[model samples]
Target: MAQCRFSSSLLLRLRSARRFSSLPNPTTTQNDAELVSNILLHHHNPFHAMESSLQLHGITLSPDLLHHTLLRLKHNSKIALALFHYAKSLPSPPPLTSHAFHLLIDIVAKVRQYDVAWQLILEMDRHNLTPTAATFLILIRRLIASGLTRQAVRAFDDIETFVLTRPTAQDFCSLLDTLCKYGYVKVAAEVFNKRKHDYVADVKMYTVLVYGWCKIGRFDMAERFLRDMIERGIEPNVVTYNVFLDGICRKASLHPQDRFERTIRNALKVFDEMSSRGIEPDVTSFSILLHVYSRAHKPQLSLDKLKEMRERGICPTVATYTSVVKCLCSCGRLEEAEDLLGEMVRNGVSPSAATYNCFFKEYRGRKDSESALKLYRKMKEDRLFAPSVHTYNILVGMFLQLNRVEIVREIWDDMKESGAGPDLDSYTMLIHGLCEKQKWREACQFFVEMIEKGLLPQKVTFETLYRGLIQSDMLRTWRRLKKKLDEESVTFGSEFQNYHLKPYRR
Candidate 1:
């Protein structure tokens, strides 16, 4: 979906949603800019007020104005929809265009208002407006963005049923890339096989497939695709090998002790092989190598790669710096990591929250609570990036492990208020902590909330909570949790002590 970016839009320059005592009095002295000012001010107004404001202008809406206004107020879906409808309700309705519809769809769909979006599509159909590939493209992107991979796949079927029998190569690939990116590689392949005959196969298409398989850590399948592409006379490019290397690093991370040497050799062999074939490894290539070494906690190798990158005259990006910094932190080389961070700032590479997170994690590991909290506050105050949910989980778990129950409560509430989260891990850790503290009521409350949010508890969940409940004679709360587990089809194994999130895992 296209970003509205209303803050920078020229229309928002009408004036920051400052409510003047009265609407700008339209007169001969007033101009078109002021008129837009009055209309655009509705972003901060309710539907009725915005509709009233639009009527006060006493002019028919123009398609161009509608398009621009929607773009400007896209962040506020209700007001945009109100203005869109107000334009249609005029005594002499102005002509509407697909641009207006698409803009509204883009705005509403972002908030996961799929029903409203589909309704707009129906309205477009009634207006005799034919949908374009761009229309479906926006839908596919949004669907995938919301983790709706199946719906995104069905939207591809929509392209054939509603838009065209045979979508262009670009359209097909757009959907293909969307599906593959969000861990929907199998669905992507199925879509490809069903539609592959309609278009000529290309290297980019196979590259996406390779990336998809690699993303899921199926190295064998990824290599098979690489071989298949070559057999089909579609030579792999540097980008292809870069993505493959990234996959290698991710796969290696899961079994570092078992595959450390083999993975490093395999990764470098591919890197050297690319060079030998005259495919110049780009900065991304170096960053991938740095990241792989970082994942392996091979700090020296990471530095060597960093030096090699500089020797090749490839300027390191933020990602490159982050990879090496991570390696330094993970290996307990805090002094060297701090020096590198200073170097990163001196070299004008803006440190991302990820850069700071490395230090935050190291501080936590050392139980340096003061430094950890300071780093966390600095990232928030500077607005580098929102602290990720993983960071919040770490913080919560850290305080809990230290037996700082009051601080743990504060952090838990703060995460919910800040919208970072109380994800599954957060809940699990907090529950474990609360139960250990014998705060059974709070533990049960959090456990219920976790279930309400559709998160399944792990094996440790039942073993701890259930055993405690029965022995402690808290059958009331126990009944509630047991009912939830039953409703979710979670089972206590025949051993009556083991459990898992999924039945198969149990």
Candidate 2:
């Protein structure tokens, strides 16, 4: 009887333990669903609940899960493995919805995965999810980046026909940007022409198109676009003013004497219009205009713009001071240029290679070899090795001008030691200097050395050598050069041949 009682007690204890084990632990699953829902809705922190849930569920989250998680998290990766897996795992994968497809397209486009983006779009269409204007815009941007402008337009036409909804202003702006980037400014203008009735082109679109025209040297077209923008009630922005100013600066820098006056007038007109529109000029706008005026020898106007910049609370950049210095130098105002350089240093604007080079060039032009050498030494002290061929050539010219043959040789050797070999200009300067000193034999020997070093002497070299020989009345040398010219079949223009033969005839 006692054994039966003990057995019954044991059975009752076993049942109690089993029941306790089977009961859900409140803390384990405690409000987990609520936590997940709250995370999905309220908390944007990607680190919340989802990863923990996956761990708790003992499920290894694949790339697809991570990708969808990231998309939900809004982080962009170059290759979205999660998205790829998500697309692969869907049973009867729904057509790529426009929104999701566009997001993927943009991500891929930014990463330059054109092929993958195109494939995704094709798969989306296969799933019958029609693309939208945004879809086409993303493709257009990618195509332009890939240098496929023609294909971009064809895609745009397809989107227009099938997407039903009219393209937005943003869409037109993107198309314009693509066309402008690819040197198809005319095609970009055509896009604006067709869409003019639908959506008025904004300042950004017009600016891009104008800049594109400027890039292709179509300044007239760029001006017309600027006028069109104003006529269409689109006020130009700082970017517009900056681009216009830059275009003027480029033209003036290239052809200062011939086109300077007209370009400066047009630039000032834009600046005045900018002021009338209550748009304050930024540092870039001020700098470009200052450069244009300075190059045109209009220092007073450049100074006035500088004052205007200061009044507007826009501090001049290093570029601004450099432009001013360059302008002053070009107009034979060296003292003023030096003062401006000193002022720049006081203003905490560090001079660049260009600034020092300008100073050196001016000094060299005045035969002030001492000052040029001082500046060159200062440039070296600043740890700025001259990278420009022009800078090196200027120093060489200065040394040659001073009859400092040893220093010229030193500079040439230094250039080669620094891994910067003599270019055609450097060779020309050296050869000319040698011949001018009545060292024809040395010049010919140097010419031979240059040829041995694989440097081709320019036509100018032959002319200089010929002139030197004739000035010395060395008929034998002239006959040798003529024979060489005939043997080489170097076609000399009538003027050059006449110039060479005149001294020989005399």
Candidate 3:
């Protein structure tokens, strides 16, 4: 059915091309007609062929047919082809109607061809086809998708000046949504503040702006927006509440000078407000509250919140348990963290890769390699084959610390066998390990391999190798590495160079 619909749409476009060609100059028309017929029968259905036919014949399709074809192609998932054909069929000193250009812009946007869309808009201006509100909206959406919010707003202003249509609430909402998506929450807030009186912003738009501000750690602006929403008699939704909660949690996490007590108090205030407003807090809300409380070293309060969740008939998710486990690990309560992991299993909440990673990191930090390796094996048994780079680095670092060079080589081989080659950090960690073990020759060989693979050694990597060579009293070898660094133009800090020079002078 889908294929039939697509083929039918293709046929309709071809018929339109035929009609367009037939009503023209005879000599040119004959070529267009043959081209159109060939396209309709061609083994490969290239939309570009029709475009080339229209251009060759100087065929200008009527605005209505162009609009209709665009809508049809869009609905049938051939929008890119439609726009290409439309651009080709557009007459020089093009039709004064905005609809043709508007439809073309929209089709280009839907296909995410922003550069071509913008070029077409520029052409529209050259042809004196004024851009409308709908035209600006299409441009705004495409720009936002491409992370060009500033350009989107400029285009919006141009739309207003050229078309004489005032921007609507939907316009402002679209702009705000775009800004928020691209991490420009402050710009979004400014736009909202200036335009709040011009258009009635909805809860969803406010929520989006608030979430954006919160995500980028602009809590002050987020609070102002919340207050503004309340002043406008717009009730906050669950999303709004989540954004506020997230803001408080993020502030607590990032602010070293701010007391955890303040974070805890702020979290409690939000929770109390939700309760007062008869908004039942979801598991995510509970998780944030737990995380903040755990960070504040209020473990009892964190655990109590979990109990509160159960009492309120809100079942905890794996995410909830994972957050708690991570909190325990952060607080150095490894036993408690492990107990929470066991509890998650008992509750049938399957452990995720994050769960294994958190526990494995904690064990490795304590030099409990056996347990960490056990968890690593369990991860593989569970079919989580791609251990993160951090995990691999940790494993390699652990073996190196224990002077287990043979095991490190085995692990490196296994990593390659699994088709997960070393990243810069991976190579650096192994090289550092080799250096610490006084395996200068092996380290130099690995460095050569890294260079051959086009991996540039980090500053610390060179420092490690240089230090190893100096300690081994291999000044000639160190000079060779120095020459390589000079050739590569790897900048060594004065402090590092001076440190190296001190030993060489001795």
Write one digit per residue (lDDT tens) for candidate 1, span 1-506: 12235423433444444332234333411343345534456334553645544543444345555566567677778777877788777786657788888888888899999999888877887778988778878877889989998888787678777775567898888888988888888888888878777877787888898899998888888888888878888888988998888888765753646677787788888889898878988999888778777887889988888988889888899899999999999999999998998888898888876887788788888998877777667766877666777878888877777887877777777689889788888898899888887788888989888877867777787568766676677879877887776665543324333453332211
Give the number of the best model, judged by lDDT: 1
Better of 2 and 3 by TM-score: 3
- Residue pairs clashing in model 2 are 63-82, 64-82
Model 3 clash pairs are none
TM-score of each: 0.63, 0.55, 0.64
Give the worst 10-residue stretch by lDDT in candidate 1: 20-29
Worst 10 residues of 3 by lDDT: 36-45
Q: Considering TM-score, where higher is better, how would the candidates rank from best to worst?
A: 3, 1, 2
Cα RMSD (angstroms) for every candidate in the order listed: 9.9, 19.9, 11.6
Q: How badly does each model clash, as a count of residue pairs?
A: 0, 2, 0
For 354-466, candidate 2 gives per-residue lDDT tens digits of 88777877787789877777766666677654546677788888888889888788778777766666777888888999888888877776665665565656777877887
Top TM-score: which candidate number? 3
Model 2 TM-score, all chains together: 0.55
